[model samples]
Target: MTDVESSPLGSERERIAAYPLAEAIPEDRLNAELAALERMDEKPLPLRIPGYFRLGGPGFMGAAATLGAGTLTAAMLSGAQFGYKTLWVSLVAMGSGIFMMLAMARFTAKGQTPVIQLQQREHGWFMAKVLTAFLGLVCVATVFNFGQVALGTELVESISAGLGVDWPREWNWPIYGLITSWVALSYGRGGRGVYYVECFMKLCLLAMLLCFAACLIVVGIDWGAALKGLFVPWLPRGAQGIDLFIASSAAAIGVMDWVFFNYAGLSKGWGPRHERLARADVYIGFALPFLLISFMVICVFAGTLHSAGDVPTTAIGLSKALVPLLGETGAKYAFLFGFLMVPLTTTVAMSIVCAIGLHEIFGWRPDVRSWRWKTCILLPQIALLGAWLPSPVLIIIVIAAMLSLTNNIVGWSFFLLLNDKKVMGENRSKSWGWNVGILVQVTMLNSVALMWVLNRMGLWG
Candidate 1:
């Protein structure tokens, strides 16, 4: 990796730093898109709505990446331990994140500069490096990979055993690495490959939602309580409560979520004309799917395992807990298949984020064919050892809490950049409501982190 302060930019890397990622798009296609945007202004509302919907890709990829093990463990534990009490955490956390997500969209579309470069120019070199290394390398590429690998390997192993094939559990990581690396490395090959990758993410998001919703239906829930839990705010007491709250909220939106959504937009070459389309993508592709999955997962466990004496901590154990409730074979497989999608889809999306982030951090022009890109994308494969690791629940919660605490730094940096007049010019946000939303997000993040600390120290709960 090139040192940001010490290294001088070569011509090719300098060009990459100055322009929008659209510069990498084929000239004819880029021209065609610009022309289409021009004609889109003349089209009526009904016609443009469909076009906006079709333009969604980045949001779903973000959804896929964050919807992995951290989310699953948080939701599962929340439902089982607290019933519907922590439901509002998911809503507020994700809602608060929207402010930052929209801020990123506007900045990327209007500025057309990569976020890392923008950070360096506006915030100084050290702050930029901290955000890049922590958010990009540590959060996504390291800590987050632990849970995804552990849960993913367990689900695959369990599924195979259920089918009467007894593969050795020790080799699970190597097999998983081969399969996921092939799929992730296939990205950026061409237009069709990118489209297929987008479709695959969409399918994974849809399937995960459907499977969890089915399980929720089987166990059945208290609609009135669920609604109250979701809309009403009630904070649970003690260290465990604080930890769950932090985990659920942070998992919804954290360092990785911001990096993935921002870079994915750049990768898709979105510009000023795609601004509205980007907002629609956040609500439709990312927010809607994420909220539904989290809600249903919590509701399912609340109904089935809330009072079940002992709740399972492992993925396989959780699926098996649903067996009596769902009926033999039908219950475990349905839940396992849906649960399987969580890690599988997440690993693919996170690999892409890692690739983009490393390139930006090292000041290299991103190329799908580059050896560095290939190596970075496959870095999470080392996490397959998570198969034999301890409880994913603990691993995921620790990762989320760590990110939530550090999120203060990254969130503030983005907030500053978004409101900078020199950087955004007239495109800078003027909305007071958006500013308040971001302030609330930062406050909530720090408060939860603080609460966890106090509770751990036995000073407060």
Candidate 2:
């Protein structure tokens, strides 16, 4: 055979030809041939994974979504009522979230397995099943979580009507849900799709941040007071301040987002080699909420709304606060854009999380086209839509409580596996890393659990 004929492609062709006429080519061979054909038709390129931090794509899309309706609501409420004092809660939440997520990413990257699968391996079938059930509940709760955004969007539209601009509310929830589903479906398609959605989310967040910052600048608020509000953590005089702090804290350490974020990292096939990039991605994601949403929103409210005693219960309320500082046109547009992005991306993230959870629970293969998987995800959301009018504040509080109760379950599962010599082997968390992570998880769980109990008892109010 000539040199070209004796090449790997030629050898593969020879093997296929040698098979019995009636016999089918092996699946592996068929896949190889198809891959070869694809390569032949395309230019030779370096290996690159899209939406992978090390490869130059953002890794914060999931977290950004987590910071959506719930976060925005919390920030608006905190700022309007407590001004910069509550800003510290957001900062603390962001800091805590960053640390936990970094550990999550590292665990996934080093283990090279989905978090659910890791739980299954380390904890056995029964525990795995229980974990799956827990996750499934969380997934169901996520629909409510996504519903917050949809409801928020509708509220924004309602508010805008006073400005003579009417956004249609016909089938609003379904339309928003579908749009959110589509964005998520696109992410499942590959890295390029995720990159597009993440970019769009960032743009929306940036606009809101800029508008809030501009208003703060124009209002000429006391820099000293604003700075003091951020750094000086003080509890309000009444029980309400403590309740608000707990609520805001819960919003910040939102459990579902962390679970979803780690899974996204695994879906992208991030490994130890990408550790630095993953860390950077987590930092960037954490900063978006801390600097943009928390700081800027607080400044806007502290400078204008607090001074006027105009506390906002929703994004629209905050927008009204902005109107005086930024004019009606700017405030309306900024709030509209921010409101839309928050729900849209959140719905997308929740959809994907639900889909992934279903796949894990039932051993359903990860095929986007699988009717079983799609139904598993879509059905729950449909039920949520029929259940109630979406309540952003209520959903945020519920999510926080749910996460607080379950965080220990998942966190302990992971921590044990990371430390177990048989599971992680040489990949175990370092001594200092383990100590810090354990301390943080234990502290957070206790704090959140206490708050949850207090709220349940109606003592928090």
Candidate 3:
């Protein structure tokens, strides 16, 4: 890659507001900043297994955020409904996430302006503000975070059941609200925010992966069907097709995941030289764990729940389906523990994403310790309260649907940025692989969302 300092892409003035503090830094200080970036970049990439593991964070956060309660619920439902036939969805989802993340990382490495600012500066689309500020905050951080709250509460109740204690269902809301609030407040400083959350998510992902993998082994999965599901795409007949569409969309990391990953990379001080490390982070830290845990969820569900013909309407219900395979307390408690960790990580991870998005949008100092912490970071919780009320199943479904739409908008917008000379610089153009991959993302996410919308509008009939 050409050095960002020498790249004759957008002028310094043109890259204004690329970061929260970029515009105000004087010109000579620009060189000092770039020099510091170069100093960090000069550090050699990690070559060993332990080295790569040590170098990872952003992808762990991305994986943690992607495997939220809704995603767990959706994966389980797919397993319970269609069995291993939909394993391809998890692969496809991870593939799309890597693709979108590549473009965002390239933008981070090459452009002086952040992707969200670049979005707003785009003349016609006018998407940056909505994609980051509105959707990142409202649709993603708030609306979806609400579902995590509900899922967290449900898991709490499920754990209560497993313990043979009749915890009142009425207390789930306030109890979870307080617990998640405490979790959110723990990120008191910016660097500490990223490190604490990343370490926490790594533990959660490892625990979830190990627990489910062990369970799936105990159940003796059909490798033939599992391989086929990974390589081949199959949807059940009729209305199930629509469900497959949504499940597939949800399985992929959406707009919020993309934004969070890029910002997380920035949080780690990643620049052009760390580009390959970034990809490794996504593949190892995010995609592997995401697909492994996801496939395990699907397989375990397919073996027990689908075979038994039980429909799971909630996260707890899905956990309870594990009872026959592993016995009551083992199944529910194991599932409950993992389920609680997934949404809890999401609640904490997305708050940082919200904070970062707000920082980019409002030019706040990128410090999590200041008033910016209150507005940029913590403000979304108020909106998240909407998920706590008696949200109709339809409302939750609508939020998930809107996320699919937001993923499309952000994905397609970044695809264009991959080609924008001003944004990505000359040597920073996208490869044919990334180009084809993004085309697939735009086609898959947008077409499915459009089909769902058309079906709801009676146009598909």
Candidate 4:
């Protein structure tokens, strides 16, 4: 097997010609992107960065979907408890996850096939159906929405409180639900709609980064210690430390993230010409934003709440904690607003995932304008019920257990597809380095999942 960088493809035109664009992508649009890539490739390395960076979208969407309640909570908990010791976990997890995404990007671009179709054809109907049903519909549509909406409601309440409003928390869900549903339903409208959704996601990402960065600056970071923690891998002794490490690591990537990213690219008419752009998208658009945001979150908590012995796990708790500890309402508001973007952005991305899942399950092409597509995208609205009803803790626990066990199995399936000559053709990964990266991701995810199982069973923890 030859290295990807040194593959014997001979020329850029030949490489792209070998793997033509799939019909899902508009040929005219892909041709334009290919022409752009050719122009960029002729320039110096420094000149190409801007072109690559400008073309990224799907990666940002993946980052948005994965950056919701789970990531924020894990980063908050890690900083509050370990005080920068577990900071490396987020980096490692996201880095590893980025490798998997890069693989998916390569496969999707060169093969120009939707992941669900490839799975059904290469793996089998049973695995394909089960993955879309349980992994996509159940976990993403139901369980994930419940968590994101609940968090979105809380964030809205906190933002309202910070602004000196007397808005009732009880009414927050409907408002948040309506806003998110409108934003989510806007996707797949047309090229412009997809562009708008991507722009909105980019804005949210920038807002989050700025808000958190401002908070960290106001709180005053211990750069020496934080840098050490960022570079050095360390986990505290005992079960709690291990659990935090695993949570932060595992939360960066998931089945939903994978599905959303691949379809998001396809929706943009990406083909083999977009391969490098896809990698740039993941590394810059996804990995960089995720790492920076999680890092800032951990730093903010580490500075203020680490030794307080009363670290709050929820965003509400942390937002409330910020006011007194920092003695500045602006700082508190900044943190609240920044963190609020998490669930808001995640809800939109997850809605897309569920909608895509619905289309894939029925072997139908995605049509954002269709009643079925619009209906599926609104599935997250059901999560508004979470605002009134108590969070089903036992049910969440059961779902978490199930996802932990099955998530890695899905990773293995992707690995097989990536390696399958029949599916990938000339695009089949030949690099030992790439395979090793995937192996690490699959193995680490499996280990973390098993650890979760043991924790649930009262065996390991």
Best by TM-score, which number? 4
- The list of candidate 2 runs beyond 4 A from truth reads 1-58, 125-129, 132-137, 140-143, 146-150, 159-163, 168-171, 310-312, 315-325, 383-402
lDDT ranking from best candidate downward? 4, 1, 3, 2
lDDT of 3 by residue, 281-378 (tens): 87888888888888899998887777676587676667766665666335545656776788778887777777766666665566554665656556
Against the true structure, candidate 2 has what lDDT? 0.58
The digit string of per-residue lDDT tens for model 4 on 296-327 reads: 99998899889987767775676577657766
Q: Which regions of candidate 1 are displaced past 4 Å?
A: 1-24, 27-50, 329-331, 391-405, 450-461
RMSD of each: 5.4, 8.4, 4.9, 4.1
Return whichever of 3 and 4 wins on lDDT.
Answer: 4
Score candidate 2 by TM-score against the native: 0.78
Q: State the weakest 10-residue window (summed lDDT) of model 3.
A: 16-25
- Which residue pairs does candidate 3 place in steric collision? none
C-alpha positional error of residue 334 in candidate 3 after TM-score superposition, expressed in Å:
1.7
Clashes of each: 0, 0, 0, 0
Lowest lDDT sum, 10 consecutive residues, model 1, at 2-11
Candidate with best lDDT: 4
Across 1-461, the per-residue lDDT of candidate 1 in tens digits comes to 42222223332234234433434556566457657766776898777766655668878888888788868888888888778877998888889888888887786566667777788888876666666554544455655676777777877778788889876557667777776788888777665456567788888888888888777767788999999999999877656666778767756776667767767776676666667777878887788888889899889888888878878875557766765677653655778889988988888887777777667667777777789889988876767767776645455455545555567877788888888988877788899999999878878876776665555456764
208 in model 3: Cα distance from truth in Å?
Answer: 0.9
Better of 1 and 4 by lDDT: 4
Please give the ranking of all candidate structures by TM-score, highest first, separated by commas: 4, 1, 3, 2
lDDT of 2 by residue, 214-323 (tens): 65566556667777877888768766776676667765654455566666655444444445556656666545544566677666667667756646666655665566
Candidate 2 clashes: the total is: 0
Model 3, runs deviating above 4 Å:
1-47, 172-175, 188-191, 328-331, 383-388, 392-406, 453-461
